[model samples]
Structures are given as structure tokens and as C-alpha cells.
Target: MRDPLSKKVVTIEPSGIRKFFDIVSEMKDAISLGVGEPDFDTPWHIREEGIYSLEKGRTFYTSNSGIKELKIEICRYLNRRFGLYYDYDHEAIVTVGGSEAIDIALRAMLDPEDEVLVPQPSYVSYVPCVVLAGGKPVIIELKEEDEFKLTREGLLNAITDKTKVLVLPFPNNPTGSVMTKEDLAEIVPVLIEKDLFVISDEIYSELTYGRDHVSIAEFPGMRERTIVINGFSKSYAMTGWRLGYAVGPAAIIEQMIKIHQFAIMCAPTTSQYAAIEALKNGDGDVEIMREAYDQRRNYLVKAFHDMGLSCFEPFGAFYVFPSIKSLGMTSDEFATKLLMEEKVAVVPGTAFGSCGEGFLRISYAYSIDNLKIAVERIERFVKKHCE
Candidate 1:
């Protein structure tokens, strides 16, 4: 009998971030900081829109491209916040979530053996999506000293003739690193010179602490070559709504919409309606949540520092990647021992990439009370094993 599974699917590993989640669920009183989900409920105004839609019997399919109102709102939102614009009619496709946008973008553009440069440590889906799209995953390992920003040098060194696309995950998950406009400008020339396309994931664009999140597409000559993927999940606390959008060259978006049309018809009608309210009226709620997250982020950084842990100050997203290399333990061992002994769970940084060894990704999306409890346990565990 022939094997039934596609070898490509078999080669892919499950998400490393969720490795300990099942265990934590069953372990009573465990405080897990591994998940990237926002703790806030969908804001009442946003949820009310969804309820209103249902009450009005607006529970049918939208167009394959999405309702014009939402797409236009997205364009306005991007322009007002990040200084970028797109043709709502031809260049944007509303997706199920940012995850789906990532998958379909890869599917739309990748040809067999097309090399995609994926920077680490990044969101776990980038590599697998590239592979599943029949592209070769070329990893560009971002360094701690560089604060995990992808440098022009790193981009140039990773490119070969086969390289076609680069996945730029900033306001990055796992590490919470961000690339400023200046940082992006340094690499824009490399991309244009090589004629490489970009899939820029900016899902955490709204959660930055000190500076506004800049889009790579904002760089001159980059808007035409970059596919910007963003959504309401992180910013509006609408993760379960499963709504995201991709904006790019109309040619590329046409192909992505073709894939989305056959694979997912449309995003949920209720979610799309709710999302309009999110964009129009949800900014205040998002700002409130962002402030809470910023407070927690600061508390965790100081707690780790006082405990002798080396943690870089992450200005975006809700995570801190703290090094455990000096504690004489691997990231996995440190996380596991802490969970077993103190009922605290964190994702080992290696889940993001091999370069993430000796570090752990702890999310501050939980409440400050939960954060303080977790930090106390972590401090005790660090003392037990510090070199």
C-alpha cells in the first residue's frame, strides 16, 4: 500500500509554542505565559455590532473580496496610522485571520523551490507556510545584540538567485522586536536591488509602547513590492472573530483572492460587521488595553532584571524574551523545571528558532496580578539554578 500523507505535510512540525500548553491545562493552578492571546474580551461596542448584525439577519456571505465598507475602513486606518494607502477594490483581500493571510500569500506567489528568506526568531507559521507553498525556507538568524531587527547585511547575505520573497515579521511575536522606519530604510535598497518581494506581517502594529509601528511598505518603491498583512486579532482583541486582510499589488492580491475564494468563500459576515465597528469606534478600547499591557510589560522587565535575568526591553507586542543562558540551563529545561516546581509555564525561545536557545518567551497579555505571581516563582527558580 502506498503512503497516504503528503511528505511535505509530514515534514512540518507542530507549533513549538503550544508544546507545553496541553500540560499546563491539566496541571492545576498553573500560570502559563506561553500564549500570545490578548486577555481582554472583545470590546462591548464591537460585540454589539456583531449582535446587531445577527439581529438584522445579516448572516450571509460577503463578496469574495469582502464588503467595500470594511476594506475602505482598513485603508483609512492604515493611512491615518501608518502613512500608507491601497486600492480597496483591486489590491486588498479580507482573510480569515492573520494566520490565513500568511498561508494564502505564500500559496499565491511561491513556485516550486522558490527560496523565501524568513528571519528568526519569528512567528512559527512563516517557515511551514513557505514549505507548504512549495518554497524553500532560507532562515536568516537575527541576533540578540541587534535586538532581533533584520539588518541589510543579513538580508544581502541570505539572498541567492532562487530567493523571491522575504517574510518580515516585525513587532515580532515571541521576541516582541520592532523595526523602525530607519531600520526598514536600510534594507529597502537591498530588496529593490534584488527585485525580491515582501510579505510584511504587522499584526501587532497597534501595541507599541514608545513609538508608532511603521510599515515596510511605507518605504519609497516598497509599496508596490510588499504585501502587508494585518488584522483585528491583536489590536482589537478580536482573535476569535477570525478576520484579517492583505493589501498589495493587485496582480498578487488577485491570485490570493482566487485562493481565498475557493478555500474560504469569505470571512464571517458577523465578524466583518463587528470589525467595522472595531475600526470606527474601537480605538479607545484598544488604547486602554495597550496601556494595561504596557504596564505589565514594564513590571515583568523590572522583575526579571532584579532577579538577575537578562531581558531586552521590547517596545512592541506583549512578550519579553529573557535569556537563561547564564543560569546553566537550556530554555526547555528552565521552562520545564519552573513549571513543575513553581506552577509557572513559559514558552522556550527555541520554539521561535534555533537561535532562540537559552531564552524564553514570556507574554504579558495576562493581568498584572498574574504577572507578579509568575515572576515571583520565576525569581525563585532562577536562584535555585543560577551559576
Candidate 2:
């Protein structure tokens, strides 16, 4: 009998992060530094609101575009934080998560073989989503010397006549690189000159250490070409709640909503209600979590340097991308051996993209104690292996 499978479904590779996770799960007493999830619980007030929604039987779907209140709150949050305004009615639609928002954006924008300029090492989803949307992903490697920031030259080099979009994953995953206003300003001309649509995944917006998070839309004449994706997941520790939103030009958002309406109908009703509370009263939680993460980041970078591993001191996001090249092993080998020897599970850098191969992404989302233990174990493992 012939196998039942669509070629598209069959061709897609499983996420490299999850594959290593499954392997790590089989080992005992593993201290995982690999996960990107916030270790903190959802803030009490936000949780309470979700509970209140469920109790009030607000379980029914509100609208294909999601609740008006949540969208309004998102608009306010965007304006207050980034000075990027959105017409909540026509320029925004709540999605199940940032993941869904990304999917919808790619599907709605790309025609078959259209090129998407994706900066890497980035979140693993970007290339696959581009492909699934019948678009070609042109991966431009972000260099360590540049703090993994997407360069203006790189953006310019990646664009071609077929280029239709640019997926901006910053503050970047794995790398923890946040582009500054000046940094983004450098790329503005390329976008306008090339007429490329931008998907600005700013999920780590609240986690920056020094400067306030800057959006590309904040640049002159670029708001009309940018889709800003943000959510309560990282900032509010609301990962499991699955709430996010996208804002863009009205025409683009309307097309995206059509895709989302047929595909998801609406985002979770209770999560939307909970997100309203998050937008209104959750700034404190963000500050608290960001402070904790900053402490961990300091500790982890120091520990890596002490252990003789070189790393760029991450300025944003809850991760440290340390070079594994000095260890004389591939990132996969380092992660696997560390898991076996020291019971520490870090993600291999290559999981993000080719540019990540010489590094290891160590998430600092765990407690300080766990971070200490993981670093100590890694030191021992590195010594034994390198010696």
C-alpha cells in the first residue's frame, strides 16, 4: 500500500531544539539550561483575571479578530512602550501566540518562491514558516563581532527582485542581541529602497538591559512596511496562556485576519481577557522578572569566562551565546557530552542556523541556584574534556 502523506508535510524537518530535548529527557538528574521558557509563574493578578474569565463563562469565542478590549490594550501598550501606533480596528488582530502571528504573516504576504530575508541564528520557526508559506528563506548570518545584530550590508546583500519580506527576530533568540535605534536606522534605507515588508518579532522587547527596546517602525516612513509582533509570553511569563498580537498596515493585517479566521477562528477567549489584565497591571511583573534575568545574565557570563569559554555579554533576552570553538568540538558534541558528564542540558547552537555552529545557547531563565549549579557542572565537564 502507498503511504498517505502530503509532500509538503513530509519534507518539513522537526525542530532541532525539541529533538535534543527528547534525548535529554531520557537521561536522569539532568539540569536543563536549554529551555527558552520563563521559570517564573504567571503574575498573580494576570492569573486571577484568567480565572475570573473562566468563572464568568467567557469561554466562548469573541470574534475572528479576537476581543476588542485586548486589541485596544495592545495598541496602548505599543504606543506607550515603542511610540508605534496602530489602528486597533483595522491594523491589529490577536493571535493564539506569536507563533501563530508569524505563521499568518508569512502565509498572508508571500507568493510561491517569494524570498524572505531572515537574519540568523534566529528562532528556529522563521525559515520553516517561510517555506510552508511557499516562500524561499534567504538566511543572512548575524556575526558575533557585531553583537549578532543584523547589519545594513547584510540586509542589502540579501535583497533581490524576488525578495518580498524580511523577518526581524530581535531582540534575537539564542543570541540575545537587541538592535538599537541607531542600529535599526542603518537598515531603514535598504527596506524602503527595496520595498521589503518586515516582520519584527519583538517578543523580548521588555528584557533589554540598557536602552529601551526600539522598533523598526519607529524609523521614519517604515511603519507602513512593518508588522510588529509581541506578546505576554516572555514579559508576563504567560507562555502557557498562548496570547499574542500583530500590528501592521491595515491592508496587510486584514489579509492576515482572513487567514487566521479560517485557520484559528479566534485566539483563546480566557487568555485574551487575562492579557487585558497583563497590559493594564503587569508592568511590575516585567520589571521584577527582567531584574532577576539581568542578575542571572551577569552570573552566567562571568561563569562562562571563568570556565574558559568565551561569550558575548548578552544585552537582551534571557540567554547567553558562548563560543564553543575553543573546546575543539562542535556545539552538538559539547552539549551531548555535557549532558552525559555533568547532567546539564544546553541547546547546541547549530539548532538555530549555520552561524550558530561554534556557539552554545544557554538560557538563563532558571533560578540563580540552578544557574550556579549548571555553570559549576559545565566548568568541571569542560576541564575534563579539554585536559
Candidate 3:
């Protein structure tokens, strides 16, 4: 057979997270922590609303931009939470998930060979989406000593004439890092000076421990250039429902909606209705879940430290990235061996980026019992590997 794949497609690799997932599924009763999905179901009321919508024959596709009511709620929610507002009519579009918002944002903003500066170890999708959209991904390594946060200096260094967008993955995946408004202030002047656009992925905005999540859009001058990607997935435990939206200046959002219109007619109708419920009534649920996660965070951080793994205290999200260098194996090797030997699954830090090479991401989204079991197995695995 002739080489048939597009040149761009050939350069991509299967998600590194999926490799551990495949191995975990093959084992019996593996305590898996490789995925960032919330362990809770969509709250009962939210689920009921979706069922009611379906029963009412609200099964038709929504307007390509999404249901107006939902967008209005989104506007209210963003303004209430982060003090960032978008025009419900023109500055927002519902998408299949934050994933699609990411894709469309990249497509809408990137020209061939334009540069997208991404901080690593961030989400797996950010860089690849930039590539598929015909842009270059410039990954700036976020250091563990900085709590895995991107520093202002690194941000300044990574910028060049071709840099058009920066993917700020705060409340970040894999590392459980978050940027406070004070933390974000350091980068704002650099962004303004460089005239860069920001694609802020804030899906974990509600899960922060000490402070409320802040949007870059709250900064002066940044509002016009920042596209915020948020969803019902992490905050409302609606991951399977696949509802998300991007809010930005109408000009950029209009362009994104055009790409979204052609690629996905609309997000799931039932999910949109459910999301409206989540937005209108789900704040209590988020608080309840966040409390539970906080308990687990405290427990797991202690557990990791007791086991001789140095983990940056996770300030947000459900994951904790612990350095595995003490075990004298690569992060991938540690993750692989833990699954094989102890039936425990975690994602290698290196899966996120090269800066993550000697770390491992352990999600604490599972029940405490399951987390304890997984950590015990990991402790045993590390001791055995170390010996």
C-alpha cells in the first residue's frame, strides 16, 4: 500500500494516556487513576432535566450557536464567577466539549505556520490541536519548583514574531496546578506587550482549593484577546454529556462558530438542556463535590509524602503529580510496572510533556478506599523497583 495518511496525521502519536488505559482494562480490578474524569455522576436534578428534555421531544438539533437560554446562563455564570462577560448572542458558541472548543479556537485563530505557545506539562490536546490547525506548537516547560506554573520570564522568552496565541492551561491537567489572579498578573503585561491572544482553558475553574479561579479576560486589554473554554464536564460532573462553550470577543467567536457549524452542527440537545440546569442549579453540587475532593487531596498529599515521593501540593483539580525520580525509573516505566505488578494504573508524567519525564499523575477522583488501595500498591511497587 502506498503511504496514504496525510503528512500531518503521520506526525501525530496516539495519546500517551490511552496506553496505560488500555493496559489497565486488560487487568482485573485495577485501581485506575489515569484519567481526569470526575468520579461523580451528573447531579440527579441535572440528569432529570436531560431526561425531561428528551421526553419532551427536545431532541432536535439546537441552533448552531446553541440554545439562547443556555448562552444567557453562561453569561451570567461567567460574570458571577470570574467577572468576565460575553454577549450571549454573538460571543459564545456551545460545542461538543471543551475538546471541540479547543479545536475550533485553534482553527479560528491560527494561520499556516503561526506559533501557539503552550505551557507544559499541560493538556495532551493543546499542542496537537495547534498542529492539526496548521500552526506550530511551542511548548514552554512549566517547572515543578514553580508549582508547575508557567513563569512570566518563560512566557516572555518563548514569544517571537510568529507567536499568535498562548494556551494558558491553568487549573492545569496532570499537575493539578492553578493560576490565581495574582499569579496571572505576572503574565498580563508580557501578553499585552507581545500582542498575543490567549486561549484560556478553565474547565476546572470550580475545583480550586484556596481561591476562586480567575480568568485572564479579567485583566485590562486581555478581555478582547482571550477566548475562554469552559464546560459542564469537570465542574458539574457532566463529562459524558459532552457540553462546553467558548466565549470571546464576538469577532473571534464568530469565526470559531463558523468552523464549529461546519464541523459539528451543534452540541447534544439534551446535554444543552441539562447544562442549563447545571448552570442554573448546580452550584451547590459543585461545592459538595469540591469539599469531598479537598478531603481526598489532604489525604493523598500526605500519603505521597509519607511514601517518599515529593508531590507539589495540588491547589486545584483532582490530580497530584509526584516526582518518581527517587524510584530510579522513568515515569513511563514506573506507570507500566505499577499496572503490571500491582494492578494499579496511573499516567506517566512524561505523557504530558518532556518536562514531566520523572513524574507521575495520580488522580484522587476515586473513593478514598480506592485511592488508599492504589497508593498502597504504588508504595509497594516503588519499594520493589527501588530495591
Candidate 4:
């Protein structure tokens, strides 16, 4: 019989993050910090809106781009919070999630062998989506010494004649690294000079500490070429709601909608209604969650420090990427042994990228009490292993 699967699909590896998560699910009494989900429930007002929509029988599909009110709300929300702007009628699209927005944007722009610069460690979806979309993904390994922010030299070094797009995953996943306005200033000129377009994933925009999350699109001349992808998942705790949106040049969003309309009729109608409420009145809820996450983040950093573990302080998102290089064990080896002996589950940093080899990505998105317990287990394991 002939081969049934496409070689392209087969060549892509499944998400390494999920492997440990699956094991922890089946392991009794295991404390898994492997997932990146917020422990908070979707804010009450948002849930109420979804219920109201259902009661009103507003369960049908929305326009392929999204409901007009929701789009307008998204624009207003971005402007109020992050100082970015977009036209509701032309430059916005509602997607199934930020993940879907990333996928469709790559599909809309990439042609075979068109190079896309993907910085790692990042959200796991970028490289595979680039491959499936027929783009050659060129990885730019972000350095810990640089706080994992993409640098001007790195951007210039990665670009070539074939390079067309750059995936900027910021207020980043796994590493919790965020790009400030100054950091963005350094790279925007290079992108403009190289004539490279950008896919800026700003899903964690609301979670940054000390400084605000800066959008590449907010810089001069970048608005026309940068696609900003964001969603209700991390910020609103609306992951299950499955709604996200992209705002970019009308030309790009139009093409993305063409793909979105056929592949997905629209984002879920009920979720769209819920997200409207989320965008309109959910700031307080997000602030509360962000504060809680900030506390957890600080506690984790201190715990690692007290135990003599090497962990950089994360200023955004609810994760801490701690180096396990001192333990004389690979990330995978440490994570596996920690799970087996200590009954605490964390993802190896290599799950995010090859350079993540000596690190572990532990999420602080759980309760303070759970975090304390996980810390105790981890410290015990570290002492045992280090000895």
C-alpha cells in the first residue's frame, strides 16, 4: 500500500511539553507544574455574557472576521491598554485562539521555502505551522544573558535573501521574557531594512511587570507590516472559550480571513459574545490574576535562590525557566527523575527548543499553597540529586 500520511506532517515532532503532562495525568499524587494555564476561572461577567447569549439563542455563527462589536471592543481594549490601534472594519480577525491566528497568518503569507525567523524558546506552534505552511523556519536562539529578548544583531544575522517573515513571541512563553519599547526600537530598524514582515504574538501583553508590553507594530513604519496576534486565553482565563484575533494590514487580514472562513466558519459564536464582555469590563479581573501570578513568580524565584538553584527572575507570564545544568543532569533526565522520585512534574526546557537543554520550564500558574508544596518536593530532589 502507498503511504497515507504526508511526509511533511510525519516529519514534525509532537509537542514535547505534552509528553510529561500525559505521564503526570496518569501518575497518582503527582504535582504537575507542566501546563501553562491560569488556575483562575473565566471572570464572572464574561461567563454571564455567554449565558445571556445562550438564553437569547444567539448560538449561530458570526461573520468570518468576527462580530463588529467584538472587533471594536478589541481595538479599544488594545488602544487603552497598550497604545496600539487598528480599524475594526479592515484590519482585524477573530480566530479560534492565538495559536490559530499564528497558523493562518503563516499560511496566508508564506510560499514554499520562504524563510521565517522564529526565535526560541517560544510557543511550540510556530515552527510546525511554518513547516506546514511551506515556509522554511530559521530559528534564532535567544540568549539568557540577553534576558531572551531578540536583539538587533540576532535579527540581522538570521536574515538572508530568502527571509520574508519574523515570528515575535513576546512577553514570551516558557521563558517569560518581555521586550520593552527600547528593546523593540533596536530591532524595528533592522526589520524595516531587511524588508521583513512580522508576526508578533502578544497574548501575554497584559501580564508584564514593572514595564508595559511593547508592540513592534507600535513603532514607526512597523504598523503596516506587522501582524499582532492576541487572545483571551492567558489574560482573561478564556482558554476553553477558544477565541483569539489578529490585527494587521488590511491586505494580510483579508487573506487570513479567507483561510479562516473556509477552515473555520468563524470563532465560536458563544465565545465571541463572552469575549465582548471580557474586553469591555474584565480589566479588574486580569489585574487580580496578574497580581496573584506575580506573587507566585516571585515566590518561585526566591525558593530557587534559597535552594542555590539558578533561575532568572521572570517579569512576565506565570513561568520560571530555571537552569538545571548544575545538577549534572540533562533537562529531560532531571524532569523525569523529579517526577518519579518527588512526584512533582515539570517540563524540560528542551520542550521549547534545543537550546533549552539544561533548563526546566516550571509554571507558577497554580495556587500559592500548591506552589509551596511543589517547592518542597523540588528542593528535596535538588538536594538529593546535587549530593
Candidate 5:
């Protein structure tokens, strides 16, 4: 038989984060700190809304862009939370997940070989998505010295004539780095001068600690050029709901919705109704969960330091990226050894990108008790390996 698969699809590697997660799933008594999902349940009020929607038999598909009320609520949430303003009717589209929004946004914007500047040690999907969308993926390896935040020099160095988009994965996954307004200001000029567009993934915005999360869209002259992607998965503990939305200029959003229309008729009706409740009444719930995560974050950072691991303090997201280079093992080797010896599963940093070697991403979304146990096991594993 003739080969049928697109070489582009064949060349992409599977997600490294999921490899360990799958193994840990089958193992008995294994504690997984690998997945970047919230441990909290969907708040009662949100669940109740979904149930009410079902009870009312509202199982029909919404408009290609999504229901008007949900879109309005999304706009309100973005404006109230981050000072971002988008026209609900024309500038937003509900998606299956933040992942889907990312996929379609790239599809809507890129022509073949259009260069996409992606900072590395970011969420795993950006590079693959760019490739699938027929765009060239240019990686900027973020440095730990800069707290893994993308620097102005780094952005300028990666841009060229072909550069069309920059995937801004702030409050970053794996590294837990966030770009402040000052930090963002440094790069906005470069973006404007280069005339580059941005896909700002702000899924972790509400999970920020210490400082308020700032959006690049908030910068002057950026609203039209930036696509903001966010969802309830991280903040409202609604991962399984598979709901996310993208807000941007209407021209771009209109094109994205065309792709979304044929690819996915709409996001789930139940999830949409539930999300309305989440946005309107779930601020307190988010705060409570954020506080718990903050407590766990503090505990784990201290534990890693006490155990002699040089861990950078991450102020956003629930992950701590700790350098395992001192032990003289590759990130994969260290993670595998730790899992086998301690039965604790944590993602190797290489999963995010090649630059993530010598590190490991440990999530603190688990309870304090679980974190304590995991820390104890990690400490023991480190001691054994170091000896």
C-alpha cells in the first residue's frame, strides 16, 4: 500500500509530559506531579448551572462564535480582570479548549513557512501547532537567570522578514515565569517595529502570586495585534469541561471562527452555561483555590531548597522548575530514576523543549499532605543519587 500520512504529522513527537503520566497511571501507589491541571473540583455553583442547563434540555449547538451570553460574560471577565476590552459579538470565539483556540489562531494567520517566534521551555503545543499550520517554528531558549521570562534581545534576535507571529506563553508552563508590565514594555517596541502579531496564552493569569498578572494586550497599540487565549481549566478547575476562548481583532477572529465553524460546531452547551456561572459568581472560589496553591507553592519551594535542589521561585502557575544538573544526570534520567526509586512521578523539563535539559517541573497543585510526602520521597531520592 502507498504511504498516506502527511510527513508533517509523522515527524512530530508525542507530548513528553503525557508519557510519564500514562506510566504513572498504571502503577500502583504512584504520586504524579507531572500534569499541569488543577486538583480542585468545579465549584458547586458552576456544576449546578451545567446541570440546570441540561435539565432545561439545552443541548443544541450554539452559533459558530458561541452563545451571545457566554461571549458577553467572557468579554466582561477579561475587561474586569486584566483591563482588556473586546467586542463580544465580533472579537471572541469559544473553543473546545485553549489548545483548539491556539490551533485555529495559527491556521487563520500563517501562510506556509511564515516564521513563528516561540520562546522555549514553554507549553509543549506551540511548536507542533505552528508546524501543523505550515509555519516555521523558531525557538528562543529562555534563560533561568532572567527567571525564564522572554527578554527584548531574545525577541529581536529571533525575528526576521518571514516572522509573522510570536507565541507569548507567559505565566509559563513548566517554568512558571510571568512577564510584568515593565518586562512587557521592553518587548512591545520590538513587536511594533517588527510588525509582528502575538498569540498570548494567558490560561494561568488568575493563578499568579505576588504581583498582578499583566496582559500584553493592555499595552498601547497592541490590542489589535494580540490574540488573548484563556479558559476555565486552570482558574476555575474546569479542565474536563474543555472550554476556552480567544479574544482579538474582529478581522482575525472572523477568520478563526470560519475554521472553528467547520472543525468544531461549538463548544459544549453545558460547559458554556456553567462557564457563565463561573465568571459571574466564582471569583471567591478562584481566590480560595489560588490561596491553597500559594501555600503549597511556598512549601515545595522551601522543601526543594532544603533538599539542596536549586529551584527558582515561580510566582505564576503551580509549577517549580528545579535544576537537577548538580546530580550530573540528564533530566530524563533523573526523572525516571526518581519515579522508579520513589514511585513519585514528575515531568522532566526536556518535555517542554530541548533547552529544558538539566531541570524538572514539579507541580504543586496537589494537596499539602501529598506535597509533603512527595517532597520527602524526592529528598530521599536526591540523597541516594548524590551519595
Candidate 6:
């Protein structure tokens, strides 16, 4: 029989992060600092809400856009936290996860061969999502010297006449880099000049340290052109809940909702109820978790430095991108050798993009005890290899 699978799906590479995770899962006593998932459970209040929804028999599917109450809470949370305002009725759609919002947003906007400018050393999904939507993925390699934040020169250099979208993955993954308000200001003119729409992935917005997280959508004239993607996953330790939302212009959101209606119908009913409680009463919980992550962040960065690995001090997210160049090994080789020799698993920087070649992404989401153990193992591996 002739092959029935779509060539596009076959051609897309699987997530490199998951490849290492699979290996680590089967290994005995392996400590993983690979995945960015939070080690914390959903706060008791949030979990209780979900349980309450189930106990009350709220198990039916919601409206395609989601429960109206959850949508209102999402809008209120965005405004209260980020100063972003959207019409809860027409401009917001709760999704299965931020991942679904991303996929449907791209599907709603892109035509075949439309170009999307993606900053590299970003989350692995952006490129593949664009490709799957029949859009062209144009990578703009962010520099380590600039602390992996995108610059105006790089933005201008990457944009072409066909460029239709920009994936702004900030409070970014893998590298844990964040773009400050000033940093984002520098690119507004370029985005305006190019007429580009932004898919601002702010999943880690609540995890920022040292300063408040700024959304590009908050910039003047940018709100109409930006789709703000966020969820309870990273911030509330609600990853398993699979609830997220997208906020943008009504025109764009309407189209996205159409795609979502056929594809997902609605996000989980229990999760939406849980998310309502999250938005209403989860601030203290987020603050507590954020403080914990910040402490671990400081500890891990110091540990990397003490071990002679040069690490960028990440101000956001729960991962640190430490340069592995001094050890004279490619990222994959370093990660592989460390996992095999010391039984501590970290994702190779290249799992995010080629620009991550000489780096390794070590998540700080694990507990202090687990992190301390992982650091010791990593130090031992480095000493054995670097000597």
C-alpha cells in the first residue's frame, strides 16, 4: 500500500526535549533538570475548585469559546496584572492549553507560504507550528551577548515582504531570557513598519524576577496586532489542567474561535472552573511559587558559576542557559555524557534551536534538595570530562 501519512507531519522533527525525557524516564535514579514543567502541584485551592466542579456535575462541554465566567476572569486577570484589556465577550477564547491557542492562531492567520519571523533559542513549537499551518518559518537567531533578546536590527534583517507574523516567546523557554519594556520598545517601529502581527507567548510572565514582566501587546498601537497567549500551566503549576486562553482583536479572535470550535469545542469544563478560582484567588499562590523559583534560580546560577560553567543570569522563567563551551563539547555531547556518567539529565540547548549549540538548559523548577543533588552530579561530570 502507498504511504498514507502526510509528508509534512513526517518531515517535522520530534521535540528534542522529549527525546531526552524518554531516555531519562527509563533510567534508574536519574535526576532530570530537562523539562520546564513545574514540580509543584496545583495549589490546593485550585484543585479543590476542579473537584467541586465535578462534584456539582459540571461535566458537560462548554461553549466553543469556553465558560463565560472563565473568559471574564481571564480578561480581568490580564487587566489587573498586565494592564491589558480585552472584551471578554468577543475578544477572548479559552483553549486546551497555550499550545492549542498557538496552533489555532497560526491556522487562523496564515496562508500558504506566509512568512513568520521567529526568534531562535525559543520554544521548539513555533517553527513546527508555522510549518504545519503551511506558513514559512523564518528564524532570527538571538545573540547570547545581547542576552538572547531580539533586537531591531535582527528583526529588520529577517523580515521580508511575505512576513506576516512574529512569534514573541518571552519570559522565554530554555534560555530563560526576557525582554524588558525598553527592549520591546526598540522593536515597535520595526513591527509597525512591517505590518507584522505578534503571537506573544507569555506563559512564563508570572515567573519573572528582578522586575515586572512586560507584554509587547501593552505597547501603544501594538495591542490590535498582538495575540497574547497565557495560561495557568507555568504560573499556577497547573500544567496537567490543560487550560489556556488567547486575547486579541475581535476580528482575529473570531476566526480563531471558528477553528477551535471544530477542533476542540471547548477547554476542559473542570479545568475552566478551576481556572476561575485560580484567577480570582490564585495571586498569593503564584507569588509563593514565584519566590521559590527565584530562590532556586539564584542558587542554580551560582552553582553553575562555582562549577566553572559560564551561565547567563536569567531573570525570568525557571531554567538557566549555561554555556558548555569551556568544556569543549557540543551541547548534545555534554548533555549525553553528563546523563550517562552522572545520571543527571538536562536538555541540550540545541533542543530549542541551533544558536543553543554550546549551551545546556537546566531547569530550576525542581526542589532545592533535588537541585543540590543535580548540581553536585553535574559538577562531578564536568570535573571528570574537563580534566
Q: For model 2, state the Cα shift of residue 337 in Å.
A: 1.0
In angstroms, give how far residue 109 of model 5 lies from its true place: 0.2
* TM-scores, each model vs. reference: 0.99, 0.98, 0.99, 0.99, 0.99, 0.99
TM-score of 6: 0.99
Tell me the whole-model lDDT of each prediction, alpha carbons only. Answer: 0.93, 0.91, 0.91, 0.93, 0.95, 0.94
Give the lDDT of residue 280 in candidate 5: 93
* lDDT accuracy of residue 98 in candidate 4: 92
Q: Clashing pairs in model 5? A: none
lDDT of 6 by residue, 166-271 (tens): 9999998988899999999999999998899999999999999999999999999999999999998999999999989999999999999999999888899999
Give one digit per residue, the lDDT tens place, for model 4 in 93-146: 999999999999999999999999999998899999999999999999999999
User: Which residue pairs collide, candidate 3?
Assistant: none
What CA RMSD would you report for each candidate? 0.9, 1.0, 0.9, 0.7, 0.6, 0.7
Stretches of candidate 3 off by over 4 Å are none
Model 2 stretches astray by more than 4 angstroms: none
Candidate 4 C-alpha RMSD relative to the actual structure: 0.7
Worst 10 residues of 4 by lDDT: 209-218
Give me the overall lDDT of model 6.
0.94
Lowest lDDT block of 10, candidate 3 = 378-387
lDDT of 5 by residue, 1-387 (tens): 989999999999999999999999999999999998888899999999999999999999889898899999999999898888899999999999999999999999999999999998999999999999999999999999999999999998998999999999999998989999999999999999899999999999999999999999999999999999999899999999999999999999999999999989899999999999999999999999999999999998899899988999999999999999999999999989888889999999999999999999999888888889998899989998889
| Model 1 lDDT tens row, 273-351 | 9999999998899899999999998998999889988899999999999988888888888888998999998999889
Rate residue 181 of model 5 by lDDT.
94
Off by over 4 Å in 1: none
Please give the distance, in angstroms, between residue 334's alpha carbon in candidate 4 and its true position after superposition: 0.6
Clashing residue pairs in candidate 6 are: none
